[model samples]
Structures are given as structure tokens and as C-alpha cells.
Target: MSDNKLWEGSTPFKEKSHLFKYRNWLADNRNIYFNSYEEIWQWSVDNIGDFWESLWDYFNIIAHSPYKSVLETTTMPDFKWFDGARLNYSEHIFRHAQLEQSAIIFGNEQGDYSELSWKDLKKKVASMATYLKSIGVTKGDCVVAFLPNVPEATISFLAVNAIGAIWSSTSPDFGTESVIDRFAQIKPKVFITVDGYFYNGKPHDKTTVANNIASALPTLEKVIVLPYLKKEDVSGFPKDFIDIHTIFKTDGGELVFEPVDFNHPIWVLYSSGTTGLPKAIVHSHGGILLEHLKYMAFHNDVHKGEHYFWYTTTGWMMWNFLQSALLMGATIVLYDGSPTYPDFYKLWAFSENVKINHFGTSAPFLVASMKNKIAPKNNCNLSSIRSISSTGAPLPYEAFEYVYKNIKSDVWLCSMAGGTDVCTAFVGGTPFYAVYPSEIQCRALGVSLYAYNDDGQPVVDDLGEMVIDKPMPSMPIYFWNDPNKERYKASYFEHFPGKWRHGDFIKINSKTNGLVIYGRSDATLNRHGIRIGTSEIYRSINKIDTIEDSLIVNLELEGGNHYMPLFVKMKPTYKLTDTVKNQINGLLKKEYSPRHVPDEIIEVTDIPYTISGKKMEAPVKKILLKMPIEKSINIDSMKNPESIDFFLQFAKQI
Candidate 1:
């Protein structure tokens, strides 16, 4: 709306855009008129039934039985989608399997690279599926995995889904306690893992951790181990552990997909678990299939034969989202180990080498690259990349500019904001929209999102809680073990009686219709009478060359006074000095407001983040408010668990 477009599309690109094709299809098939993307989006939300039904037809979703209706109810938590339909999640993924097409391309920090053809992928999945069935894994049985972003993990997931069993996984970086806390709740019948994994040029043997997890879960029938790191050294593994090679040794049979109810559980994803035990959020086969089909084919514009890559570990939901690219016939690129291992530009190099069409990563990665002044265009030929997606956290305004100026001038930088609650984005980019700095292009089609004030009324062009007034097919069908639906209700519905409160602070631009996410509403900083999103403060601090990362928290003192301290992780070459503190405070005062300055500026060794790459603000706030550290957060789920020590000491002195 400002006419400050970052990148203009070519005529050919616009003609081939999925949005353009969908608009034409709507006009032709449904006799609907949509003059613009906004009009199409409005129709999608207003006539949710027609939109979803059209999506099923457009995507040509493979199902064993037809649905009686698109949706039976429209209420939150009670919404039923694709009623009377029976399908398997893996069935649709293998529908596009071609003998010569590359299914997965995997790489790691050790310089190991491998590619799996669609033929080989199907064979491996079949073998693994037969092995799982031999071990008594049947429909509705839980199968948990502890592995990296390797091909084996992908194969196991498909195999489990093919058998109609629930599949859940976490990266091997998680400690035993964190894995047990999540997998124990699901009562997995089969456990799959690797003996070890490589991270930051070092080998981490997870044999002990796997044994501990298996020992804790009494329902586990068998443990399958892959010798990923130090293949010859399997001495520490439990006696009952079976080598993964043994399962894949037999002649593979034809793939068999067991059709289950539309609402049958496909995968169980977990909440961040920063506060307490993680919630096991369950998503369904039909729900995930329809959502991913629409998201990848339409929203992302993923086409067959294109290489789609998202840098993620198996622990995060992005891995689940990335794997869906295969369903769309896109070759998925899986990278294990560190994104910054050999250098800060490792992923960029990989993107160029593989000719990735759509490259996705976290906001912090982009911010770090910007601070380091690493220019991908200087060393890598990224001509094949059409779009770069940033998520996990809000992309700072500076980072958005860096991608356009420093990375590539021609590519579309799509910044999205969503969470593990739905395993997909609520607001993201569309090929039809213009790229605006620090703003999500639009609310995803079919998602009725609104910014609600504290009084539960929708607000325009103002910061408020992000809520969904309508039901999404991808919304968690139920929380595992939440029998009476009490936990599920308290999680999303407690804030607004029937609407789903996403708990993120956001604003919708009245003129542009673009969305900007602040930080989590629960972690918003309130000093004196003003409320500030921590992201606003971080955006200002990140401009300093010496500051690598930062987190801020506001705590109320016993005497009704408030203490707002800013914890910063500075570069090794920089020191926390009076001049440096003044620079940071000055930036906040000049860029934001004088009220945005912190009471104290402290240096920290590192910043704690969840394995999924989110700042641990709410948990840190609890610690600063005199809550026990163990009870406040799960250390094992953190990327840098030791970083909490600095905050604990600082909290004690206060």
C-alpha cells in the first residue's frame, strides 16, 4: 500500500503463480468473482465450506471413502472436518512417487551427503512398515522416534503413518528427561532412535539417553537403533536394542496404506514445555493432509520437481511441515548438524549447490547473518531461489532489509508467524502480494484471524491478542490424555469463550492489510503504565554491532516498584562498559520511547532458546519473579541450558 515494494515480479512469474491460477479456477468453476487477492481471501473465510471443498478437489486428495460433508460443526474445539471420510496420511504422500524423481536430499556438518530416489524411498518405507507391524504396532498405537533430520527419520515416519499408527519425534539433542516427559505421556509402543548424532563438529552419543527413555516408558515393546555416528561402536546400547539395518535387510513388499477415520490421530506434537510438562497436541490425517496440500500447493507455490528446503531438526514442527513438501511432489532437502557449523553461510551454500527453489529458516539465523555481515551473493550463486521464508520468531525490520539488500535483490522474503499449536502458519506470504519489510504479507487464506483488544472486540491498526474467530482444519483435534477436554479448553478457549486465542501480540495495518507480530502476549513487558513487546526492544538493540542477541524481562518488586533489566549476549571482542550500556539505552530511547529503556543493562554469556529456536521469555520472566528454575522451565529442551545460570544469579541478588 506504501508503494515501497522490495521486489517486483516478472510477467512469467505472475502468470504462473498459484494464486493467479486459483483465482481463475474460482471464476471458471464456481462462477465466483475475485478482482484481487483480498477479495479471494474474503470469500475463502466467508464461505469456508466451499473453499475447503474446492481445495480437496483442486489438490486431488486421495481418499478411500468420500466425505458426507465438509464440516459438521463450526464451533472451536468441537469443529469436525471431512466427516465420514477414511484416508491414510502416507497414502497421499506416496501418490506422486516417481521412479526417477529425487525424494530427499540429505546433508550434514560432516560433509556427508546422500540422495534418495522415490523408488528407494518407497522400498525403505515398505520394509520399515512391515518391521513395525511385526513388532505389534497397529492402528492407534504410538511410535516415538529420537533421531536427527536424516532419511531414516523420514522413512520411519512414513512407515508408521502407513500402518495407521501415530508418529512423533524429537531431535537427539534433547536430554533424556525432556524426551521421557513427552513420549511417556503418549505411551509409545515402539521406540526408534539413532546411537549418536553430530552437532557443531562433535559427536554426541545418545545411547545412554535412549536407554533412559526406554526404561522409563513401560509400554515400549522394542527399541530400534541406527548407527549414525561411529557406526562400529554400539557397545553401550541396551541388550534389547535391534539394529535398524536388520529391519531393512529383507525384500521390500508393496506399500500398504491402512485407511482410518478422518479424525484419526496422525502425529502428536508438543508444546514448548517451558512452564511445565509439555502438552501432547494431536493432529489428524485428513486435517493435516488438506491443510498441507493447500499450504504448499497454493500459499507456498511449491511445484513438482522443485527442491524445497527448510533448515530444521526432527524435534521441531517445521520438519513435519517440510516433509509435506514431498506430498506436493517437491524434493525435500534435509540438513542435519549445525546451520552455522563450518561457517555462518553453510545453508546458503547448500541452497546454491542444490538449486533450492524455496529456502526456509528461522529469523534468528537471518539476524545473526546480518550482524556478521555475511553476504550470500558475494560467494554463492542463488539464482535458483525464488523465495526465502523466515519464521520461528518475528523477523526484525533490519533483517528483512538485509535479505533484500545483502542476500538477494530479486527474491521474495516471506516472513510468517504461527506456532506448533496448528503445525502450520496462520499468517504468511502469497505469490500475489507485494513483499513489505517486517510485515507478514497477509492472513493465510481460509484462516479467519483478527486482532482482539482486552475487551474481546476486534481492533484495527492496533496491537492486541491474535485470535481465530473461525475453526481451521489443522487445529489440534484434541490434547492427548485430556479426557474431559479441560486442558484443551484452558489452553485456547479460556481467554475468549469460543474463539481460539493464539496468545501472540500482533497488529494489522489498516491500509496495507499486512500483519506485524510483537512478542508473545504473555511475555510482553509492562513498565510503569506502558506495555512494550520485547521484540521492539530487541529490534533496537540488535542494531549495535557488538550485541549478538538479547532478552528483556520486567519484574515487580515487593515495595510496588518495578525492575526492568535487559540481558544481552555481546560478541567475544566486546565488553560491557559504561559507553556500551549508554549506546544500547540511547538506541532504545531514540528508536522507541524513553519508557522503553531498561533499568539495568547486564552482559550474559548466551541467550536461552527452545530447541525450536524461540526465545525463552516467559520462563525467564518466571525465574526473575522468584519461581524455581526447574519448575519454571525444562532445561533439557533448551538449545543452551546453561545460559539460565546467569539469570538465576542475577535473580538471587535482587
Candidate 2:
């Protein structure tokens, strides 16, 4: 692909004053080697040593000792970044504490607004830190938070990291079993939770769930509860259970920041394991800091001091990624309810009131809005949004077109896809690229991504397995319970030998320099010796407004031959009539092929989704086949798991 195709925009974003400032700084400072994004990306691949060292230097990384070397010569997984560097994750985020800039912009579905300036946020974190330290939460201890995307949650996270304690969190809606399953393994010293959460105009009390988890785990010493609703009974806490507002008296306290090594664990992220148990993926301080900085600065083009908002939860990787904007001194807008609550135009209304610059959400949400025939253009002003990122699933062409016609035509539509294993993206949107209808703009800079065929050889034109050729800085340090690394190996490397198989089936359009991700490669349908992607069908079926949402799976009949079966949830205002069904089949046949249309179309009320918002196709398939579904890794956001039964009944009848 030519450079022109990669960069087709009439206005050069690189020449923008704010973007050019970094380029000019790089050129003036001979200490930093790279002069441009292309040069830096190439150097990061060539000299892996000077590249990361320079990246740390260019970003003014606060480290105790400059590393002896950038990387070690060894196996891909074992190689380390910043071998001798020592730094604390929390200190970097608090670097601009004394400034009067904005830190957090918070609101709910009810239009309630709250703002936290940098100075106030710092003071709150400091006070919380003092309270935590007074309670004996010292270095190397775990602090788990069960809260929503409110200020208290962010403050508690910062407070824990400020005192050299590891932080982990999940949304308050997590069930008692799901909460205990993961937190019990860590044996946290303190538990931070909210009394209740308001979602879609309903209140869900989390105190009972918190008490149940606390009872199961004996090591929990303190339970700090914030009263979002009226104070509820502390079910299992001792006499020492206290309210958060009572512990922290003053907003200002001397911030005692602890310094630690680069490789010290920062966040314990969990991955949903399809087989039985979820894997606790541990990410290091420096790895997450540097990787997020690079992605925000170069790929996402996050301007400093701008308001950045991504609708996600603590259970999702985007929540972690969105928090990194604070490291860049950017104000973060956090919302904690359904985007379509009360109406489909809620998100756009919130964005208009907050004046968000960069907005991030999932493709499924947009697809639903398009099917419902709701356009934000009539309800809200989305003029301030410059970039719109869609992830958690592939962005279908119709959804892209909907955004262009209904949202803003000038915004960059970035369709990014990555998983919880790395907590980073492999393919993402770039500021210098044009928006493609159904493709990710480019491979993430510094990530050596390539498509490989079934034979383990690299392929170009056709669809193949997506794999990373080199080890990036954000690779997980270790699996929490897998000491032997056997489970880790089986998770990623077992599919292909030394290469890191990412489990995404993708096709690269060499002509346009674009990439299309199908659903997970493990779920790819193979019929008559031909493999096909499920997104290929949904992408076509979703364009019709009659279908609200849909799920496609490969079905095995009595003869062991596989066929495609589709389950669709019609729009609330419409029913699945003969005309709608025929229109869907006609569109699928005309756009895709005969094989793309499902042999069976079943109407359903809802589709099963993981806590992180990805559709749960594997478990649905198991339910269709009358097999047992392993425990849901996280069931916080699940609206209805029992809805799968209706789809199974339909499939069995067919």
C-alpha cells in the first residue's frame, strides 16, 4: 500500500500546531533520537533498545535509576523493558496535582453533573491515602474496589497506588459469586465499595454482595463504603466497618507517594476463560504507563487538557486505557448507566452537555441505535467530538455509515480490536488516516502485527489468524495462579508455535491498507472445508432496520455437518414479520453469498453478553447443544442469561 492511501486526509494532522509541537521538540532535542512518528515506529522495531529508552526519556518518565539496558536478549516472552528502572505508577499520574486544571467530569443518566478539579482530586486522593495508611495498608498489599465510574472509585484507585498498594476493581453490579471468585484469590487487605448504584433509573444495592464476598474471604480487614444511596447495613463487617466520608476529614493531606520498581504489579486484570476459570493477568507499572502514553499521544491523538470519555467499566480494558488520559493531564468524563437509558439519545445528550472531544463506545450500541431508527443529530449537538472509537466488536459497514450520516461526518471512526490478555490494542485508529467503512485504520504503532495462515506462514490477501511477531512492552508479566506457565502457553501459543496467536481472524486489504476482523478465530465456522467469519453475515443482516441485534453460530446437525443458524432480536417497536425476514435474507444474499444467509432464523428477546460487553457466542452454542456452560467470568452487566434458553429451544426444534 502506498503512503498516500494510508494518509488520504486533505488536512495534515501532523502539521497541526499541537501535533507539530511534539515533532519540533523531537527534532530540537538531539538527546531523543526519533524525529517523526514514522521514524520512531521504525526505530522502535529496529533498535528496540534506544527506541524505548528514548520513549521513556521523551515522555519524561519519572524513574529512580535509568535502566542499564532497554531490553534483554532472550525469548520473546521473557524479554524485559527498562531492566533497572524504578518508578511508581501513581506518582506519574499525580505529576500535575498542584495545577488548577480539571481532573474528572462525572455525570449519570439523570443529568446530574459533578466536576473534580486537579487540585481537588489530588487532595481527595491524599486524604484517602492517609486514611488507608493509618489503617495499615502498606507496600505490596492488595486493595480491591467495588464501585462505579464515580469520583470515589478513581480517588480510591489513586489512593491505593499512591501508598504502593496494588489496585483491582469491578463494577458494583458484579454478582456475589463473581465478586468472591476473583477477589478471594487475591486476599485483599481492604475493600472499597458503594452502598448502591443507579442504572437505567433503577437502584441495585451492592452492600449485600460486598458483605457476602467479605464473609467468604477471611483476609479482608476493612470495608469502606460510600453512600451513593442511603447507608445500608454492613452485613459481615466487624465493628470497624466505617463510612468513607467519616474516615477522610480534610480534603488536603500530605501526599506520601511510594517509589517502586518498573516491573512491580500495578493492576491485576482478569481474562474470561471459556473452559472453566478466568485467568488473572498481571500488568506492571512501567509497561502500562509507557504503552498507554504511546497509544494516547500518537494513535488516539489525545490533546492535553481535553475531556476524554469511554463508556466502560472496571471489568473492561477500555476503563484502564481511559484512566491513562489522566496521566496526560486530561479531564476524564465518566458515566455509569446504560447509554440508551430513558431514550436512545442519552449518550449524545451527555456528550453535548459535557462537550467531549474524544468519545469511545462499542459497535453493538451504535448498531442498535441504527436499527431503532434513532438519530442523535435531532436530539444533541455532537460538534465537539473529533474522534469516535468503536471496539468490543467489529464495526459493521452500516454502523459506520450511520455514524457518518447521523453523528458527525468529520469525525474519525476508529474500529479497534484487542483483548484483556495485553490490555492494549493490536489495531487502532490513527489521526493521520482516513476512516474506512468496515476496517481498522492501521496496525498500532510499535506493535509487530501480521496475519498468518493455518500452516503458520504469513499471508497477505486472504483471511488468516492474526498474530504479533514481536513482544511489545505491554505484554502481561505473569498469570496470577499459573506458576508452571502451562495454562499461559495453552492460552496463546498452543495454536501456533513460538508466535503469539491473538485468536482474531482478520483479512487485510492490501489495496486500501485496511484490516477487517471477523469474530474470534476459535468460533469461526467451517462448513464443507471452507472457513467463514460470523461478522461477515451480521455485517450484512444488520443494515436492515427490521433487525435490532443478531447472533450467528455454526450448527452441527445429526449427520455432523455444520450450518449457520441466526438468532435475531427485533426492534422493540416492530415485530419479525414475513416481509422483514425476507428483506433480511434478500439483503444477505445480495451483499454476501448464499452461504452467508442462515438456514434458520429465530426471533429472540436478548443475546447473552459477557460482563465486558462482548457477545457470549461460545456459551450460547453450548446451551444450544445441551452442554454445560462454565461459570460466567463476570456477570455484572448481564441483562438475562436465561434468554439463551429460548434460542436453544428454537434451535432444537429446527
- Which digits, one per residue and each the tens of the lDDT, describe model 1 over residues 587-627? 99998899899999988999999878899998998888888
- Clashes found in each candidate (C-alpha, N, C closer than 3 A): 0, 0
TM-score leader: 1
Task: Tell me the TM-score of each prediction against the true structure.
Answer: 0.98, 0.93
* Tens digits of per-residue lDDT for model 2, 573-623: 878788877887898789767777777777888877777777877666666
RMSD vs true structure, all candidates: 1.4, 2.9
RMSD of 2: 2.9
Which residue pairs clash within candidate 1?
none
Which has the greatest lDDT? 1
For model 1, the superposed segments whose C-alpha errors exceed 4 Å read: 1-3, 558-560
